[model samples]
Target: MTSRVPRRLYLTIVAGALIMSVAMGIRQSFGLVLGPGAVEWGLSLSTLALAIALHNLVWGLAQPVAGAMADRYGATPVVLVGAIALAAGLALTALLPGLWAAMLGTGVLVGIGLSCTTFGTVLTAVGRAASPERRTAMMGLASAIGSIGSATVVPLSQFMIEADGVATAVTNLAMAMLVAAPLAFAFLATDREATQAPATLTRQLSLGEALKEAAGHRGYILLTLGFFTCGFQLAFFAVHFPSYLVTCHLPVSVGAAALAVYGASNTFGSWFCGQLGTWYRPQYVLAWIYIVRGLAIVALVFLPKTELVALGFAGVLGLLGLGTVPLTSGLIARIFGTGNLGMLFGLCFLNHQIGSFMGAWAGGWLFERTGSFDPIWLATAAAGGIAALLHFPIRDEPVARPALA
Candidate 1:
């Protein structure tokens, strides 16, 4: 069974990871365009920041709907639609040249696209395909591979932007998304029986009941709240960190390289965290990630701004970066079972997106007002500390349900 599992699921896993790579990789590179695009498009930094912020907001808002659809139908259709939306959003953002177009293309459409393609939808499909025992480890493997996006795409984006221009670079990225669209079909390889196994508690519960159960569970609530910090910290950095480097007089290459390093480091961190979940309680792992993140931010804030320091900071952050994802999703699966994993993880992700919206928007808004990112940096650190506290007390055991009548 173990040997057969890899052969059977390899395509699905690769497809999921590739799709995630394109979605997240392109998403991470948005910061690279901010400085150049702002100048070329004649927009304030705050306006572009709003577009990114709106993207995150729309993504969060649409995630639950997307996840539910994936749960009810399948991941293929949802992912295919997401791929088209992602391509169209990128194309529109490239072709059109106005604020409304930017908002509609990058903010609304891309956000919707991301909701369908990213962790909640994709990982759930992957998780549902794996055996119960192997699920988390498989997810970790996929996530680690998915980190390839940041490592490769960010630098590619930077190169394209420099060689051609912002519009051309974005248009090319759109083409890449279209090229990757077919991979969504691989989701059909998933074993439907595994997902609907009779042993799962959530198999007997309605969506509404599952939501209620999660709402009543203290661990779920804590997990959701802690997730908010993850969003805030990550979004803040992804959107503003490049611009922040410029303010410090660091070259543009430093920003791209830093992001790339973060992505590379994320590969190992995600896999390591996922493996740790198999042996340790996921909640404790999550808590330490947050605590370490907080300290890292504090250190970065106080440290002198140099290319080396920025790169090192990105490496540390990357290590803790998307690691939260596998751990968080795995925790939900552990507590609730894989039956409603998509919807449950989506609900938690909503809170995370809310934090993302705040982080992205607030970073730009605060910087515009104060001409410094220090306040936001401090705030993000504080949020991490709070999230660590919240995760420490979470009960990571599976939910107990009465037998169905």
Candidate 2:
């Protein structure tokens, strides 16, 4: 049954979506910049890899804190700050000296910016605005929109790289971030409805207590382990896919098309995850997704390098790739309630980013060292299988409340 949607809720979802897309687009554009930046700065692949590693690390670590802030305050000011930081980071990357400064601007600065603005922050706001019944669907819609940013920006970035130059492309990306600021302003124009439910309260759990709680939660532990694999796989490909294509005796166009296909498929995947979750238990669905991903990766590794074949693999994988997001986030809301979701999910995301760091850095290091991506592909396939296994035993029900004293 379709839930009645509110106009303000719709606008808020759209605004949060745009913020995520713009923030993510600017970060994803790093692929287009890597080649040019390296050539201009005489930097090695490892250096660029380090910057991206740091970026993923910071982005992952900062998310829980950002979520906490947004939960306590509103999403507006935090997202606004992220938008400005994204612009500044890109601008600095365009004009910065030396590789170290580049890492600071592009990696640390941009990563933190995205941590504040991307899926977690926006999802929290959208979740808050929508009714309980509509929350998952709204989250899916927002994610689908954000996926468009990934899809559009890669090719657009490649085009800009060709038309003007990488430096100009970076500058243009900085300008693009400003667009989100206005969108944020529009979203914040309406006040969110106050929940009639009693405020879910928590006494600050010591880090030890929090960790103990998370550790005992079988699903949460599995989620953390499984999501690490997702980060590893995503980072491995996002940073190295273009270079890997070049290794396959194909044109760079193939790489760009592969990424583009992944982004496009991701939109469908994200949306589908939302729609499907309404009927199915999210944990079961996510487990199946991971299993399918393992199979897809195995197939892609053996698939021919023709443009059609490669793009097909990319599209199929893309569908499963980011689609995990909505399910993962939804599971958090289902099990932990959105009250402390920011912190809980932030901890979960830290696991994902740790994987991201390894994936991004290891892909480059291995390629530079081994001169082939074959081993990494095998690792990705294995990781997917492992993630599937991890989720198989996750308890989907909410934790029992503490008995009153």
Candidate 3:
């Protein structure tokens, strides 16, 4: 029998992907802003790094709460509220630019917004919307589409900054969020329980029980540990890589292009990995992604600093980047079932955020102290190797599938 996604669920996935794109696109541009923002204030790079680091940390801390909210009340309110907060945060940051303001706006508000819109909430919504057979592929496709925002929006932000100003660019993007706000209701209508009988008829397990079980699961624990490296590496690069390139006397355009390639390549690669999730062991896929990342960084460290090499490496990195999300999340659905998928994934992603915190903060702190990014690069490469090893022991058997309705 051929597997198929219902039309309404397909629309739901599209809406979720749209929200993710907006969230990721805006988040990725934080690094781009650093180079120019430094020119504006002459502030230490560490300050910007702190704000971005705080963003990741806050996003991590809030994800579980966001996921729980989605589980209980439906994801629509959570996402709608997030979009409003994001737009407000951006507009306010433009009007009043400072360390504290950036922290409150980008760090706290945008961070909360990110938690609601990105993977945990959105992907869960998609998972619940899809049939078991089609869910994995849909997960990959959603991830791919959402990632495109990064490619398109990062450069768009760069252009706006060059032509108008950073303030103007940010404010305009804030205005754009208003257009996407209506899509949230789609998730509410096709909610996790929409296709099911009354909640009471389903097998009963309190949210507390779910949490306790996941906390104790060996595979889940290992999965969370491995994800830490992803958070660390991506956040560090997102906020610091552009500045790192500029310090090397490369043109800013190379940095922009690298991010663009990252977003673009990740779109295809994530989908490919998502499809792989159904056909192969997800743990193996996750392991390979980390291994590739580690080897790529090592190679880059030893190579010449030519723009050709930098952009080429970036394109390759982008291809490998973000393939983990579907694999990891698919693993979650496979191993534990999707009953508490949002909350469980949220917990795992919390580790990712913690890693993001370390990555962003370490990049700034290390660079400021040492005046070079070498130490952090070495650490990231090592972390990648360690993470690759961590995933190997996860038992890959499919468990009882959750009623995703």
Worst 10 residues of 2 by lDDT: 189-198
Ranking by lDDT: 1, 3, 2
Off by over 4 Å in 3: 1-5, 192-202, 398-405
Model 2 scores a TM of 0.92
Q: List the residue pairs that clash in candidate 3.
A: 192-405
lDDT (10s digit) by residue, model 3, range 1-405: 134347777888889888888888998998888767755645567886787788899999999899878877788888899889888878777778887778888788888888888899888888878777777888988999999988999899999999987888888888777678778888866564732434543453468988877777788899999999999888887788888888788999989988888899879987898898888788888888899888888887788788987787777777777778878888888776676787888889999999999998899898888999978988999999999899999986654324544
Error at 78, model 3, angstroms: 1.1
Candidate models: Cα lDDT each: 0.89, 0.78, 0.83
The best candidate in terms of TM-score:
1
Alpha-carbon runs more than 4 Å astray in model 1: 1-3, 194-203
- For lDDT, the strongest prediction is 1
**Candidate 2 residue runs with Cα over 4 Å from true position:** 1-5, 186-215, 402-405
Per-residue lDDT tens digits of candidate 1, residues 339-369? 7788899999999999999999999999889
lDDT, candidate 2, 356-381, per-residue tens: 99988888888888998889888988
Which ten residues in a row are the worst by lDDT in model 1? 194-203
